[model samples]
Target: MNLKSNYLLFLVFLMSLGCATNPFTGKQTMAIVSNDQLFPASFKQYDEFLKENKVVEGTEDAARITRVGQRIAKAAERYLNANGYEGYLKGYQWEYHLIEDKTKNAWCMPGGKIVFYTGILPVAQTDAGIAAIMGHEVAHALANHGQQRMSAAYIQQGIAIAGNVAITDDESRDLFNQYYGVGSTVGAMLPFSRSHEAEADRIGIILMAIAGYDPAVAPELWKRMESSNTPEFLSTHPSNSSRIAQLSALVANARAEAKKFGVTGFTE
Candidate 1:
């Protein structure tokens, strides 16, 4: 490689540097997008979505949703604060809403904006189940997983642009970009998403435990989720059976985590 190529490679490496850990998985990950840059974008999009959707208010489900969300948020704040991540959510504006849509999902954005669909309520089944999902989704936000994925995408885009400049043939550049997109989207992005799902499950278990929920119920909820047979990728969530198995395996440890948080008389 020539000096220019070497320098460019070094620049790319430097851009990949700044690190953050997954709060649940305890794994160091590349965090190219700063929280400062990510939160505003998430907040704006969340607000726009709320404006466009029918947000239900003053129902039993809505009340339960808010209560569960607040409990998990408190648990998250306590865990992060105790671990010296106090200011991580400093500018976060947390809000929760229940949407009347029948979609079988819930999501919490980076700045703590939450949306719950009506369809998910049946499978959620109980307060602990709702806490399970909230804990998992909020864990993703706190871990900055979305920001990490965005940063990785930007890096891949930069590489593709550079490759296109170097390759004179349009077909060759097209091929390069196509291969890059597939490799980055599937190889990197999908697996990264899967990692986030697993980490969130672990974190969610602990948060539920701390919030006085029987963490054991989390596995059963996942079992319900698995029975839903929702298409994984299009739906933007994990498979029910996979999550169920993972949660079941983590039960013993989840109970231990609950003990640390002084959770007693756990639901049987």
Candidate 2:
């Protein structure tokens, strides 16, 4: 078999063996790197980041970040347990920190180390809005989006290497590199990332609703994010319009889901 074909077969084999079911989505996903391995490494990296960055604390905003994160975490635990996936967070050591940064971004590391940037606070505007953002970031971790992204990166690199090995001519290789770079990234990786973002949005609204935050606020947050523009096809995340529309559509369903957990009222 050709080198490209060989790599394809190997990828198929890896996909067959390295799969984990996401409790939230009830879908099998790639997990070449287990949480046991990903978590410790992520924890160490998070610790190093904390040492390097100015982590905001001892203030209302900082406290709000932590409070919102804890509520989301509790909602996750409750959802998992109620859905027959108790102890799913066996190694999760959830930690939330507010960092002093101007970047409008927040992220949750693989094992639940979350950092909320100061810049995103203005956009969030309220405690419930903060919960909307927090839930989305946490959902990324819960759904193992990091693991899947890493697995996709591995596949991308492997395919590049296989193509290099199979194509010999200099001109052919240059053409291959030029096209492959854009094709793999725009076609394969960007769509994968956008899907993850949409999934996180879907799961997050439900989580925030269960945690007593109004899911309707979620689309508003995304509408605010629309000012930061990136074309949907080229960006790692779905377009702001797409996010707002999806979250808006899911709000009623999220509220209904929250009602199942006896959460009737939501903060706005």
Candidate 3:
């Protein structure tokens, strides 16, 4: 086989070998970097981040962040165990911290390390609101979005390499690179990321409901975020309006799902 053919075959093999099923969605997703590799790196980075930032503790808001985070984590475990994916979170060293930052952001790293920015606490006005945010962040980790993103990036790079190798003409290769970069990002990567965000939103609501937090608060929380949202096509996350609409529609379904787990009450 020619070098180009060899590269293509290797790409296919790489893709075929590095896949894992998402228990929540039951879809095979890319996992070029396994959790075994991703988690330690994530933990290290999280620790570095905490060291660089002021972590709020000994305060009610900080306590609430940890409280909500633990509840969300337990809710995820319950859902996974009930679905027969017991021990799915083994090796996950869950930690939650409230960072004193002005950025309205909160994120959960691969190994369940989470940080909530103090700036967002006002937006996440209540425990249920915090649960909404916590659930969404935890859902991203539970769904293995980080691993999938890294794997997808590898595929994108691999395809670019194959294209550059196949096209012998310098001019053609340059043009191909330009178009491929924009086309692949806009057409494939953005949509993939948006889908992950939507899936996290769906799963987040269910988790918050099961954790005894009102899933209905999810939409309200998004409403508060609407002012800062970018256009849907250009952003990694769906538009806040879109998230609000989706969460609003899913509230009843989330409550129903929680009821199956004997969770009949929700805190507002």
Q: Across residues 1-268, which tens digit of lDDT does each residue of candidate 1 receive? A: 9755775786578576878876655677777877788888889999899899999998999999999989888888877777777776787888999998988899999889899999899988989889888888888888887877777776777777667667779898888888888777766677667767888888888888888778888888777763645566533346777788888888788778767767775643
Worst 10 residues of 3 by lDDT: 223-232
Pairing residues by index, what is the TM-score of model 1? 0.87
Specify the highest-TM-score model's number: 3
Clashing pairs in 3: none
Model 2 per-residue lDDT tens digits across residues 95-171: 99999999999999999999999999999999899999999999999999999999888878877877787788989
Q: What's the C-alpha lDDT at position 103 in model 2? A: 94
**CA displacement after TM-score superposition, residue 42 of candidate 2 (Å):** 0.4
- Candidate 2: RMSD to truth: 1.8
Better of 1 and 2 by TM-score: 2
Q: TM-scores for all candidates?
A: 0.87, 0.94, 0.98
Taking the tens digit of each residue's C-alpha lDDT, what string does model 3 give over 27-114?
9999999999999899999999999999998998888988888889999999999999999999999999999889999999998999
Estimate candidate 3's RMSD in Å.
1.0
In order, the Cα lDDT scores of the candidates are 0.80, 0.91, 0.92
Question: What lDDT, from 0 to 1, does candidate 1 have?
Answer: 0.80
What is the number of backbone collisions in each predicted candidate, taken in the order shown?
2, 0, 0
